[model samples]
Target: MKIGHYTYQPGARGGIASYVRRLGNAQADIGHDVEYLCRNGEGSDLPSVREVNGDVDLFETAQQRRLDVLHLHRRIRHLPEHRVPTVRTMHGNQGSCPSGSRFLKRSGRPCNRDYSVSGCLWGHLIDHCGSRRPGNVVNNFRRIETEHELAAKIPTATVSRFVKERMIRSGCMPDHLKVIHSPAPDLNRPPAPLQHKDPPRMLFAGRIEPKKGVEWLLRSLPKTDVPVFLDVAGTGDIAYMQKVKALVEDLGLTGRITFHGWVEEADVYRLIEQARAVVVPSLWHEPAGLVTLEAAAVGRPVIASQVGGISEYARDPFALQVSPGDVDELAECIDRLALDPERAASMGQQARAIARDRFSMDDFVSNIMDLYRSTVTTANGLMRR
Candidate 1:
């Protein structure tokens, strides 16, 4: 089958971009002809990218190529109506409000709750009538309306059950939505051997955002007795990053915390393997925590926030679940893992076992192929009728 994957803004180094890149590669590996139609230049890693300089006349090219399926990875409201089958994966709640919030009023910090009725209504009003800036108001309304239109028009796919539930609650058709967990590269490469170190190392790999709960993790450090060193990686809002640094200094944890700017994918696995445990302290309802799976692949146990789809994976023996943004509980969990060397090792082994069985790239690729084949066959049958 010939498939065309479309993304508007690529190379953001986020999960969505990573997912498309991996899916494109997986499609190639499975002997399917796939092309990534991206607006933000050509992807260096993916061999199947067809970068378009402008939005004009792109659908004509897809039609000319006779692409069987067009999968949109990003929001493009101006997408031309196509005769071919189209699938849109709703990665998050990008329509109701800004990609981050569900309400119009600013919290002055990130709010982590799932969509609320009042929040949604407030956002809609602010977008349509309340905002004084006419251009901004019009843009927000258009974006939201486009999302609703796309959801109504296309066969939608969601990355997690959490996201699917949200869509259903927001009045999307359940029949049109498919829940396919995003795939991650199988890091079958043997993990670096554990070193006998004095202080156990904890790793947090993600953008340094308030929603990521980086500050929560930092605040939790004061209660832990073990000599815990946190290696924080990734970048985000400059102000938030500065706040994190200030908090660390205020707590006199300057020595314990090290901020490593962005690291490449190749090095991430090694870093995960080296760490005693991985922490995913997300304040929000993370639809799916890919980092947790990545850490598990490296035989590293995770201490993650017990919210959203994270609970799906964190129930395993290797994972320690704590309430999101609970500094005391997070600290205690960290201390327990750090103090008990033998237990931590056992958890790591268990985590590796889970990763191999449930999250193997082979299984991910096969399941996705099954979905693609089924969708194509159904579309063909409809056309024949």
Candidate 2:
């Protein structure tokens, strides 16, 4: 099978890019021709590549690729009825919610606002949603409409049930929605020893943004009865980073928090292994918090927000589920786990066991390939009839 993928980049360090890299490699290893179609070709891992120049049209380009299956990792163009059968994966929340987190931009609260012209437009203008700028909001509205139309017909899937539910509410047909967990990096690396940091260090290893609920995490840190060292291992915009730095200074948390701006994936796994627990305090309905799975894959317990798919993985044995943006509960979870090193170790073991049992990169790719084959078969059948 000659399978091609469409995403922002081929092999960047982001979650979606990592998936594309890993899956494309695996598919190629199994004797299938895999190509990553992006604005610029960045990696040599994938066997084939097709770059989209600025003036090139995607539909005409896709037709030229002559791919047996083209999987739309993210919404690039609205070529829904292109010559090829395009399968979509709702990797993010943009199509459904304008803010893309399904949360209020100003309040950092979860939002269930159904997509409506008055509701979303006014929500962006008056309500606490992000992008108050008319230009950005108008562009988002058009994107949302394009995605809705695409979802109404395309064979679309999501990374988690939480995301599938939200997409359905936002107009994705329930029948079109399929829940599939994205491939976790097969760290093949051994799990961390039971013994961990004596004072219990916590780690948050993703983008530092408003939707990440980083401020809530910082505020909750002061409330924790026990001292917990937090190592944040990602970078964001300068203004946001400065704002968070100011918050850290104002809260007198200078001694407690450390920022490691943009480390490699190996370092991320190392940090997760060393930490007592990982925190994923997302304010949005995260399409799927890959960080939670990454933490679990390394045998580290996760303390994640109960909103979105993080809630789905943060169960008793593997993690502690806390309400989104709830300072008190998040503080309690941090303190409770920090104080009990033995229990944290036990949870880490449980999390490792869960990862071993559930997250199989090979299985993930095989299932997707199966979907691709089936989509092509169905399309061929319809054409023959």
Candidate 3:
């Protein structure tokens, strides 16, 4: 079958970009015709590509290609209902929450209120869920409303049940939604021997945004009984990074923390392999913590927030789960893993087994292909009627 994927710039570093690249490549490898309809086509590893430009309408291009199914990773307005069977993958809470994160800033807790103009406006201005700029708030509200409308029509796949539940609250039809977790990268070699750093290193990889709860991780570092060295592996939100840096100094943890801004994917895995534990202390509702899965795949014990999909994997034996934004609990969990090398090694082994049993790329692609075929067949039957 011919599959067309509409996604971001070629070889972008985020989880969504990595997912699209891996999925498209796997589909092509399995003898399916896969083409990436990307904005930037240079440096792509895929076989067929067409750079989306303003000169040609995207719907027109997809129709011309005559793709059997079009999979969307980004939110585009006005999905075609006729010839092309379009399937949208909701990787985050963009359509459901105005801030794109179901987190309230002032209260520092997950916001459960459905999207309403007055409620979200109060959240932005009073609760501080997002920017206070009137124009920015207005734009976010409009975008979410538009996406929610489109989600009702198109077949939608969410990265986790957490995301699907939020979308349902925001008016997406329950019948139209399906939860498909992101697959872990194929680590071909056997799990490496657990590397215990001298000071018991903990790795935090991903964007350094406020919702990521990096500040909370910094706070937890000083509270841990053991002297845990933290290595932040990616960068995001300049202001938030500055705040985090200031907090490290305030807490006198400057010596223990190192900021390595936005390294390559291979380097991230290398860091994971070297660290004693991987920390994912996201304050927001993570759709599905891809880093948690990656860390598990690398055979490192994960210390993640018991929020969203991270809770699904962060069970006993494989990982230690902490409540979102709970500094004391996070510190205790860190201490538990950092001080006990034997237990940490045991959890790491269990994590590797979990990754192997679940999150295989082949299984992910096969499931996606099934969804595509079912969508196309359903659409054809409807057209005939």
Candidate 4:
């Protein structure tokens, strides 16, 4: 099959980019003719690529390629419905709650909920009070309409059941929606040996945004006495980073926390292997916490919030689930893991078992391939009839 994958940013080190890269490569390995389409094609990894500018029409290019299927990784507007089947993967909540994180609103926290049609109008009116650019308003309006249109037109796939449920509640067609979790690379390299290091370390990876609960993690650090060292990875809003630094200092946790901003994928895997336990204190509903799966795969237990799809994995014996935004509870959980080395080790072992049994890369790829084949076959039968 001639598969065409579409992405907004090919070189981006975001989760969506990582997923498409792995999926495209895997499909090519399985003898499928695969091509990836992206804007600018900025990444060094994607060599044989088609570069697209703002003026270029995607539908024209897709038709020219005679693509059997066009798998879009981003929420695009006005996709031409050619004879070929097209699938859109919902990586995040771009459509449902406008804010993307429904939990943020439910918790009465400040979030980006003012992106819907009504909110866009209000935002423009409030521009007199603040700074709302014309482009931002136009973009929001377009995005909201595009989301509704796309939801009705194309078959959609989500990475987690949490996202699927949200879409359904938001009026997406249940029959057209599918849940296909993203797969990790095999990482053929042998697992790093567990090294005995003093000052038990906890790792928090992914973008340093408020939704990720990085600030909560920082606040919780001072309360723990297990001599914890936190390694914070990934890059995000510069202002948020500054706030985190200030909080760490205010809490007198300067020496305990290390901000290793934006580590590469290989380094991230290594850090997860070395850490005593990985922490994901997300204040929002994480569609699927990919980091948790990666941590489990490396034989490290995870301490994640009990929200969204995170509860599915974090409830396992290897995981320590805490309520979201509960700094006190999060700190206590960290301390518990840090003080009891034997229990941590046992949890790590169990985590590895869970990863091997449920989250294997081989199984993930196989399931996706099966779905694609089945969808294509069914579509063909309908055409014949």
In order of listing, the candidates' clash counts read: 0, 0, 0, 0
State in Å the error of residue 202, model 4: 0.6
Candidate 1 stretches with Cα past 4 Å from truth are 9-12, 53-56, 78-80, 95-118, 121-138
Off by over 4 Å in 3: 54-56
Candidates 1 and 3 compared: the better one by lDDT is 3
Residue ranges of candidate 4 with Cα displaced over 4 Å? 53-56, 103-142, 382-385
Per-residue lDDT tens digits of candidate 3, residues 286-377?
88888888888888899998877777656567888888888999999999988888888989988888887787887888889878988988
Sort every candidate by lDDT, greatest first.
Answer: 3, 2, 4, 1
RMSD of 1: 3.3
Model 1, poorest ten-residue lDDT window? 102-111
Which segments of model 2 are wrong by more than 4 Å? Answer: 43-45, 54-56, 80-82
RMSD (Cα, Å) of model 2: 2.0
TM-score on alpha carbons, each prediction: 0.88, 0.94, 0.94, 0.88
Q: Candidate 3 local accuracy as lDDT? A: 0.84
For candidate 2, list the clashing residue pairs, or say none. Answer: none
The residue pairs found clashing in candidate 1 are none
TM-score of 4: 0.88
Candidate 1 lDDT (Cα, whole model)?
0.73
* Per-residue accuracy of model 4 over 1-385 as CA lDDT, tens digit each: 8888888777788588888888888788878888878786876476456765531366677778888777788766566644467777888866565435544433423233434456535534442211256776567556656776787776777888877776776656688678877654567665664445678899999998777888888888888877799998888888878887898899888898888889998899988987999999987777788888788778788999877777766657989999888999999999998888778888887877777777777787787666667667866787888
Among these predictions, the greatest lDDT belongs to 3
lDDT (tens digit, per residue) of candidate 2 on 183-286:
55677778868555576789998999998989999999989998889999999999999999999999999988999999898899888887989999988878
Question: Tens-digit lDDT track for model 1 on 97-154?
Answer: 4333432233323344344445544544553212546575556556666776777766
lDDT (C-alpha, whole model) for all candidates: 0.73, 0.80, 0.84, 0.75
